[model samples]
Target: MMKSILFFLIFSVSAALSAQTLTLTEQQINQHLTTQLGRDFPINLGSWLKAGVRLADIQVALGRQEADKARVSGRAVVILEQGGVRRDWDISGDFSARPRFNSEEGALYLDEFELLGYRLNNQDASGQANFIMPLLLQSLAEYLAQNPVYRLDEQDPLQRQLKESVLGLSISPGQLTLQGLE
Candidate 1:
């Protein structure tokens, strides 16, 4: 019985050491975001002064910059109706945000988003974009904050074991690493 107990303790220590860190590639994160966030496309940005906006064609890029942030780029379609005249405009831009993990949910989310840059396809739409971009940014931030970019698979034993023990998340070029305090 003592021999069996010693063997079991050794095995447990080895398993714990092996599971100390979990790493995910950038591609994995991007694919997860695309699959999860795609369903909510063409989100309307309520009308203001007879002008309306919609967001679609969202794309995510992880570890694109040296900073520890994920980059998201997408197109915003703007519609302006004036005196029964309708026009459509396109504004495209990319933004970056720091990633955070929620231990209770076993999920990854974005925080502290910063708009990198934006441009209107039609110069005439500059005024509209100026008025609408802030709203678009806020909407995107709120949506992403609530929705996870990636969720841990509780069915997987290693992931399940690591979920609650994860002490912090780190982003390097092209990769994300989760490590436990121990």
Candidate 2:
């Protein structure tokens, strides 16, 4: 009886630990990005995820490279959730030029612009998308490092809400988008 009880206790603890663990894959990340946009302005997801790609680069890749005399502008909103908590970030701006259209380009190329808006929602649900928040938070962390001061405080309202997050990117393309941070 004692042995059985001990085994059950250990098993329970292990199970609890496993339940709290979250692993995010490239596919999941892409889904998170998609859900965040959810029929909003189209985003060249492939180019947006590339490493070393900044939001500005995304603007260019989206074919917004320069502010030509003739250009198109658009806006998009992204929502992210972690541990069941959700936060929203908005992106709005204009693209200057469209690059040479290529059959292989798909939906990933545009450049030139600006993002204006603020974070919304301090909490969300613990859905499958909840696990991807860590990646978003980490990306936001890197972004904050570059520009230490913004209109908001160091513990920006958003930062306080994300205090208990633990997540990482299991896979990523060559670029990452700081959407509005740029």
Candidate 3:
């Protein structure tokens, strides 16, 4: 019994000392997501806007978007206003990006923007969502071209260390795993 206890103690201590893994809970991940994606997407329609579309206040607000396999998915609302009139469009899609060569940041983009519905002149615009979606996506793409969001911590040693040593980051439904990170 004494020998067994000693062996267990040693094993526990050794295991604790050698451990170099960082695990984040779902709540923590959700909080980070909320904070990161909650920011308003400030964008300019550029040439996509017609003459009356000039000075368009185009903004997209993203809700909690889950990140998995280096890809993010979630819901978003696009708002456009001009001449005391406004339009609100809702969409759920995935945001993807490819990391630059040896760069910490990636060029983020909206891979799929599926408009769920919209409101035009304060009326249900669900019927027109299908038709307007293409235009909205076109303008959205233009804005995204200028502004791309990234989730990278180049200056953060912990994150950088994990990313450098880890083989890959796999995000699942409610868990994130770092493969062979340490």
- Give lDDT tens digits, candidate 1, residues 62-100: 676746888877776766665687777777877888889
Highest TM-score: give the candidate number. 1
Compose the digit string of candidate 2's lDDT tens values, residues 1-182.
99999999998787556532222222332333343223322222243332221231111122133222113232334554335654454433433322221112111122221223223233443443244333443343333233211111125433222223322212123222211110
Worst 10 residues of 3 by lDDT: 50-59
**What are the lDDT figures for the candidates, one per model?**
0.73, 0.30, 0.45
* Residues 115-158 of candidate 3: C-alpha lDDT, one tens digit per residue: 34333433475664666555665555454444444343667666
Candidate with the larger TM-score of 1 and 2: 1
TM-score for each candidate, following the candidate numbering: 0.71, 0.23, 0.44
Which 10 consecutive positions of candidate 1 have the poorest summed lDDT? 37-46
Q: Relative to the unseen true structure, what is the C-alpha lDDT of residue 93 in candidate 2, on a scale of 0 to 100?
A: 41
Q: Higher-TM-score candidate among 1 and 3? A: 1
Query: Could you tell me the TM-score of candidate 3?
Result: 0.44
Ranking by TM-score: 1, 3, 2
**lDDT at 54, model 2:** 22
